[model samples]
Target: MSMDDQVFKRQGFGTDVDLVPPFGLLLVDFVNGFADPGVFGGGNITSAIASSQPLLDYARRCGWPVAHSRIVFADDGADHNIFSRKVPGMLTLREDSHASAIVPELAPIAGELVVRKTVPSAFFGTTLAAWLTQRSVSTLLVAGCVTSGCVRASVVDAMSLGFTPLVVADCVGDRAIAPHDASLFDMQQKYAMVMDRQAALELCDQAAPGN
Candidate 1:
């Protein structure tokens, strides 16, 4: 099936519920490679990263258990997986590679968790689900690059793991506008609560005091 077909099929599942859950943040794959146009980066991803900065600051101030994911492979590509097969250059995101490093603006703090993975979904091979559950994090505020790829995969996994994934629309982007818009629509209709960054921030702020 084509990308559009699969996306539409996913959206047919439907997503409608109240946004009443404890919140945390998950910033996915906002690294140098995704930020540079010459590499994997392009389109509105740059704007998304900028939009995520304030959201990150707010998440920190609210004492949320923030987590970030980087798509890294072993230095020797020994850990390459199906993900790398699609984007072979992903194998270059080694431990010491600058392209793998989280953008300076959204870098994780001392206590925040940094999850490194060779897969799309952050929860697939990581302890992200357990970590959030342990911290009583019921609502996951998601932001990242390439909305149609890692972000969408993570959203599905988040739902499957019983977390309310609120995808910040303006805080996630793709190399092109079409996929970004389409993925946001699919996520809103299916796996997650998709909203603008400002709306998401306000929701988190309101939930913070009680959390």
Candidate 2:
């Protein structure tokens, strides 16, 4: 076995998590800013977005509760936080800025929740957890950009909130490949169930209603 495998095995990490019913979809920061390489985009983010289109379609077909998150700051910058201070460019993602708008392909339809936040975790200072819980979402299928950042943060918080997080590996991306791969492994070993889009879909199909 590889050293990494040996370590995880000895530590009893990377346990399998069964796919549960009442699944919800959380699309984080799949906005225009993260899609443009000249801005906060790079690596496989564009490819990830493309891959997520079908996943979104599947979620809609399954009638899963879908929620999307965007990093939007106040237009006047009055609501800027430490996150914006750390990455000054984040302040540009104002309420009406095109950069903070969800990309068209996976745009949320009527009835889907849209969460606006300035921090990494969607649940932080937001009603995302309560929203998911209200819909009886036991398992959350996660797809988004910057696997190392907002996606990871949301997955960790989802687990902490007693929700099973199933991260679609190919449907989440980072500006750098190393962090993307590393974050996926870490999440699989600790916070969430990490799988590719096809495998996730198969599991979803196998899950019975009210399971």
Candidate 3:
């Protein structure tokens, strides 16, 4: 076995969590800025977004509750936080800024929840948790950008709030491959169930009505 696998096995980590429905999908920070390599994009982010297109379609077909998050600060920088301090460019993602807007291809439709926040975790200081809870969402499928940052943070918070977070591996990316892989491993080992798009779709198919 791989060294990491051996270690995790001995330490009793990486347990398989069952995928339960009513499912919800949380897409974090797949905004214009993150999709532009000249801005905050690089690595496999573009491909991740491409792969997520089908996953998003699958979720909609299954009639799952969907939520998306964008990092939007006040136009006057009044809502600046430690996140922006570390990356001052975050302040540029103001309300009217195109950089903070969700990519048109994956944009939210009428009933999808679009959450605006200045923090990494979507659930922190946001109505995402209650929104999911009210919809009886027992499992949350996550797909988005910067796997090492906002995606990781959101997954942990989703678990903390008692939702089974199924992180679609191929649908999440980071600016750097190393951090992206590391974060995926860490999340799989601890907080969430990490699997690729096909596996996730299979689970959803199996859980569908009359299946």
Candidate 4:
């Protein structure tokens, strides 16, 4: 093992998190702006978005409560915050703007949650938690863009909110590969359960409701 791994293990981090059932799925910021390489995407983001389509379908089939988040600022930049200040370009994601719209492939259907926020975490200042709680979601399957940014933020918030976050590693991506890899490592160690979509699916199936 690497020195960092040994140190983390010695410190008792990266312990296994059990996969409890009544799962929910949160797709964070897989919007047009983030999907377009020229706008806020690149690296493996395209592949991640593609991978999430099947995952979304699977979630729908399982009747899991699914939520999709987009970074939407007001037309007048009314909701700008530290996140927008750090990346001024975030102000361009106005509510009605095309770039702020969730990508076509993984669009939330009727009755599915559509969370709009100016900041990173979908649960921050949003009704996501209440909605998931109403559905009694215990384990949350997470998928989205910018693994080091919104995806990570949502996972942390999900964990903080008492939901077991099962990060679908293949369904989340970053604009930069190094951050993408590092964030996944850190999340796996300290924040959430990080596994590829299939592994997560298998775990979910084993503990599926009524199974």
Candidate 5:
């Protein structure tokens, strides 16, 4: 066996699970501030965003239930939660803030859900789980920013909520290389199937009927 394969075996890690039918896509916090280099964005996030554009188009073409999450506070700041207590900067992402808006390139089309959240996991205190279940989504395809934080949280929550999570490796990034790489490794080992952009695209195409 190869060195990496030996490590995976020793660590009790297995390859990605085969995708279940009726997949859905969840995009977490791909906002302007998170995409720009000057704010909470940098590192490989820009490249991840660029790569995810085609995946988003493919999801639409495949008729998947595509949902997006953004960290939006109430206009008056009355909606502050513990997540903001730990990182007060989260308060800056008020309803009117440009930083909290979903990046224009991946804007939600009509009929798609846009979830406003105050925590890391999109499923925590959000309707994401119910929504996905309603759409009969068996496998959840995830693509977004900050792989170490929101993306990781959402992946764990997706697993806990009984949805198979397939995290597109090239479609999620963090502000730093260390956390990005570590999170990808950990998720691949435990929480989700960490596949590349092409792999995810092909899975979606296969899920589409008569493809």
Candidate 6:
């Protein structure tokens, strides 16, 4: 382990959370804008988006309840918030805007919830927690864009609301590499279980109900 990791471990952090049954996957803000570098995408975001496809497919094959979130504001910008004010461009991701649409690669199929939020946390003002609760989802597998921003926000909320969140590292990206790596490390140390795309899903496969 790195010297920093040894220190963190001595401080009684970075405990590994077991990936248990009844898993659900939440893909946060993998929208078109975040996928296009010119718009909001860059760094490893493209590969992250590409990696999530298999995760989604695996979730489908395993019959796990899946949900996707998009940052959608009202057409007239009536739903503006601190998030929008900070990044005013977020307000442009209105109801029917192409930029706000979840990319076609990870599109939510029928029977999956499509969460729309005006802020960072998907479970903040949305029915995400309730919806996942209704589906009996005890552990949530997370994948999406801008790891330091929306992904971290949603992971924290997921943990606070009594759900075990497993962040699929390779499947979550950011416009900035440093923040992306830092968020993964922080989330690993504190809020959630962090694993690479293959490792996380493989654990899920091993621990999945009836396996």
lDDT of each: 0.88, 0.94, 0.94, 0.93, 0.89, 0.93
Tens-digit per-residue lDDT, 1-211, candidate 6: 9998998899988898777889999999999999998888999999999999999999999899999999999999898889999999998897799999999999889999999999989999999999999999989999998899999999999999999999999999999999999999999999999989888877887886577
Clashing pairs in 1: none
Pick the lDDT winner: 2
The residue ranges of model 1 lying beyond 4 angstroms of the native Cα positions read 1-15
**lDDT of each residue in 115-164, candidate 2, tens digit only:** 99999999999999999999999999999989999999999999999999
- Work out the TM-score per prediction: 0.91, 0.97, 0.98, 0.98, 0.93, 0.97
Q: What is the Cα root-mean-square deviation between model 6 and the actual structure?
A: 0.9
After superposition on all C-alphas, the RMSD of every candidate to the true structure, in Å, is: 3.8, 1.2, 0.8, 0.9, 1.9, 0.9
Q: Please say which candidate is ahead in lDDT: 4 or 5.
A: 4
- Please report the candidate that would top TM-score against the real structure: 3
lDDT of 4: 0.93
**Residue by residue across 1-211, what tens digits does model 5's lDDT show?**
8787688879789666778779899999999989988878999989888988998898898788999999988877798888889988888997779999899889999989999898998889889899999999999999998899999999999999899999999999999999998898888888888889897777766766676
Model 4, residue pairs in steric clash: none
Model 3 lDDT at residue 101: 90
lDDT at position 200, candidate 1: 79
Candidate with more favorable, higher TM-score: 1 or 5: 5
